[model samples]
Target: MQRKLSKATTLLFAVTAGQASAALFEVDPGPYDPAIGSFAAWYQDTHGRTLDLCLSKNVSSRVAGAPGAPSYMCSLLPEPGVFDDAEPLVFPTNFPPEAFWFTADAAIADAASGIDLTFGAAIEAAFAVEEPAEGDQISFARIRIRVDVPTIGTYTVTHPYGVEVFDVTAAEFGADGGRAINMTRDIGIGAPKTYNGALGGDIGPFLRSVNGPYAEVNPATGQLDRFIGDPNLDEPVTGSPFDTNYVRIQGPGGIDLRTNLFAISGKLSEVVRPTPVIVQRATYSRSSGEAGLSTQQDVFAMAPPPPATAQYLDSAAATVPMTEANATGNWYGQSSANATPPATVEVSADNSVAIPNSTPTTLSAPLVDVVSIQRAEYSLNSGQLTLVASSSDETEPPALTATASSGAAIGTLGGDGATKTLVTGISPTPPAKVTVTSASGGSDTEEVVLLP
Candidate 1:
């Protein structure tokens, strides 16, 4: 889960031998491959503007119940109070510069995350509109607000949550002369109550909870009854789905207003990503017959579930290069098209996979397998040392730790322990040493010349 380099080997690449040196060897994690779900950071402003939004993408989400749930992977925060009314909302000129890959995931998340994250910020201070009377099956949907003031710190207080009414606007919630940022039209959905499950009525944020018999009806009875022979209560009262698209802002004293400053669409995203394999159950039924010679026939049927595939990007399209431009600027997208194809390296316990003893090794390969990296020492024209990697990290797609001095090349593995590959294109002129450590405590060292 971590990327690091050895202390001693890093020194070998930085300074001449036999002299006291303080230069530290550093690991360079280049081109975070979002294809494999890696994290990337972005700042709305290039110079770390306090008022601009700082965003991180490709973060992993842990759902409370489902261990097998796809990680809901991404979010963006819209920071208010930081920006003054005079500040423009455009990209580059008034906003932060791009620091990472600019893909649909990042951009869309930039919008959607605001709604989800805002709801998240509101969750803590949220309380049931009213305690449910015993035995009442009511599911509530809510939209919460979080406000942060610099120096004074962040303060989240419960608000009487309400939905934006067409032709009607709620009183300002913040301060006088305060600016309101409206993202409602840009990202907001239809009225809050439009989809209140079975309860056909107007629904608003923090309004009345939805009542439900969220179940399938029996065809014969045309009612919320169970199948003839099957006896079970109606499905549990799952709350109605809520769509959030608008956020209202008010100045300091709850005076001025902006109805929708920002908005983004919500995605089922990774949480429900389809699986490659699915198990489906088939039910069979037979009728009862009277006495002696009665006979019955059994019917058999076969139905195979579709294979799960990538939800966001198709396998083929994800491999193709893409260039996208938004209001901010053009960004290089993540796709196999522009990426270096991973290399495959051979692992060995002896010299079987080793380079010639006296011949120079060119950085032609740029990928390696974790297994090929046995605990061993590699010597360059000047320096030699043993490197080890570990497999202790049992997390799927285990974390990799790598270290190298300046000019050292790094390779991307196809996957955990699948195959070994060398990082390619590094020259042998600078005599740099690269060490890769695994989560399982195994290590490998390769010394190569890296010329600029």
Candidate 2:
């Protein structure tokens, strides 16, 4: 018996881009410390302030002296140092380190000093991808905005996604003489969560009506008497579910921090290369009667640059077979073309088992396939023709190539999915027709029809 499976394309509209290089600081994941508990991961800003994400229950002694420490948390200025003799907080178990990841950028100074003193920072994390036995593959992520402010003032932190303004007060400051205001969201693979997946706890720079000494600014009227403190003020914030850019601060505050966590299931087949590719794991079961069957598995990947050919590798590189029933095995394959989505890569696995004194049985199914070019537009003006192709993958748009009817290459665009535009200057008006091809081997061609 033989079988084959293909994944349906999922349309996701969003922009995905790379980050700028800067100084990065990382703490060595040494032996787990009881005092600090365990440092699962960390993100450090340009100013040297470190935010540690803990896996264990105890708070780091470095920040133990600070009042009202948080447990099972990632916050500012926490590091791995001397052990705190404090009792450890009871934390949930069975958490996997691979399920959580973090990365951040340096702080951008919005104000040098005074009431308008502020520094903007960005932090990001990658959570585990939830791939069910049936249904669509869902990726999960967390985005956090942490602001540290000294002195009472109104400030705003702006990133590629959205903008947030806060009126700080002395009472809001932490023991470090600074207030850490946080806004967080847990987003899934589909549309932006917006108001969904909001995790709010005790720690807060909660929504409070702005009063004297701090008046909110109104954009429409330029009124300084505008009252702030609406928790839902920045509703439906826009941001890619996978990545983030540097944050900028404005007004009278310092240390604005933004953090985002994304879910990664596999590595890109082109462009940037990530080490130790992330793979899928599952349990395989067989009845006792088929215990003596010999099995073989083969894995292959296909990605954009149309007419994408299948790239196959040894099953050992992609899978660790289940030696026994109900046991788990790891399976790796290429699932992404870049950091963000509109997943352009497709992965398939073929498993064959030889039955004792019988013909072998084979099963094939796509492991990954979730993005494609959903739409394309062409326009001509002043002898210049432009082609814009939109993809369903929001994270990382697959590379696209445009060709003229004369078989001449027009241009190719990729990287950011938000902006996949190709422009070319032609002599005799528009070409008779144009074809756009995606890296995933999908193509769309349309005849040029000019207005009379």
Candidate 3:
């Protein structure tokens, strides 16, 4: 239903510092339909301030408080402490594949200074589009605004995703970071999230792996590993062994409520288990020779490849309904098979601590050898030990281990060591040469100076 703008409710955001508890405001979130969707809000400040706003057509499925669904969250200013107990409004659950539109209007009855409504300013707005969400036609745009006043002097208002208030301090809106989204009648929605589903676009495949409705690109390689379905299933499987990105969905295996902050990935392939490994054995009866004609018997086919590994990437709430192309806007088109998956990002006390140390301080030098020169992986001369590190993307952090040259015992390094300390043998006075191996087999080394 369309709610027109009203004056009394407009100035809700303009409450005076001391007693604006009754300040009114409006907001509407939706599990939008392809048709028409929008939300409108208004409020009047006790100080006689007016406000009006609307969010429609652009937003992710509400995580909690949403129309048609139960309240998921509230949108109070600054810290959410005040609105913690506040409840959100609900819209009709059955929107019949329509869009969402909201309109808000408020009137100001008071102000801190003697103000005149005369020579009032015209409405102002700002918008921009992100390459990640921008499709052949559609652009993931965000809107921001600032108005000059006789009192507040240039007040600013912005809504990037249209649903959530943005922390607009960032420069170039990166993934998860809000960017400008431009919309026009000529623009079209980006590719219907590349993956397909029974619901015209089943989020089941992606939701099955996501912490929320969004998906992040693989930081390690920017490519993706395979999974069963989307994590946003209408009903998640219980006891599921699935990795929890940020939160868990329960259904099949068991109900384990958990979450993760990693990227979501994987090719959603159907597993027809209980199908059977058929072994057509030939009973060589004397008749075997009778007709050399059809003596061919089929043996059990190679076990269908062990189900593919699971992988996932994190996505922006605005990036709901991901496309075949990387929503993070990296190349590879969000394709899983690409070799340069985005590398995993890990910030450390030292961003320059790139090279790894020996796995075990043994008799030999390298306990583990990071093979890549780019540092995706490295080999450590753990004296008698060696670490066999399986590397992923090189840009982020590299995994390492040190095992004995005997191939029997192993040692830990850096974090902890069971056999021997990775750096135990390095001299405290002089630095040693440490090398890191890249996925491509290149090598780079660093000299870590030890101190007494």
Task: Give TM-scores for every candidate, taking all chains together and pairing residue i with residue i.
Answer: 0.17, 0.24, 0.17
lDDT value, residue 404 of candidate 3? 26
Residue-level lDDT for 272 in candidate 2: 16
lDDT of each: 0.22, 0.32, 0.20
Q: What's the lDDT for residue 151 in model 1?
A: 16
Residue-by-residue lDDT tens digits, candidate 3, 196-281: 01111101112222232222232334543233222122223211112121222111123222222222112221121121111111
Q: By TM-score, how accurate is candidate 2?
A: 0.24
TM-score of 1: 0.17
Off by over 4 Å in 3: 1-205, 209-233, 237-242, 245-452
| Candidate closer to the true structure by TM-score (higher is better), 2 or 3 | 2
The digit string of per-residue lDDT tens for model 2 on 377-447 reads 33444566666665433333457788888898888855464347765666766678888776543466877
- Give me the overall lDDT of model 1: 0.22
Which candidate do you rate higher for lDDT, 1 or 2? 2
Ten-residue region with minimum lDDT total, candidate 1: 43-52
Per-residue lDDT, model 3, residue 34, is: 27
Q: Report the C-alpha lDDT of model 1 over 98-168, residue by residue, as the tens digit.
A: 12111011011122112211322110100122221222112112232232221111122221222332111
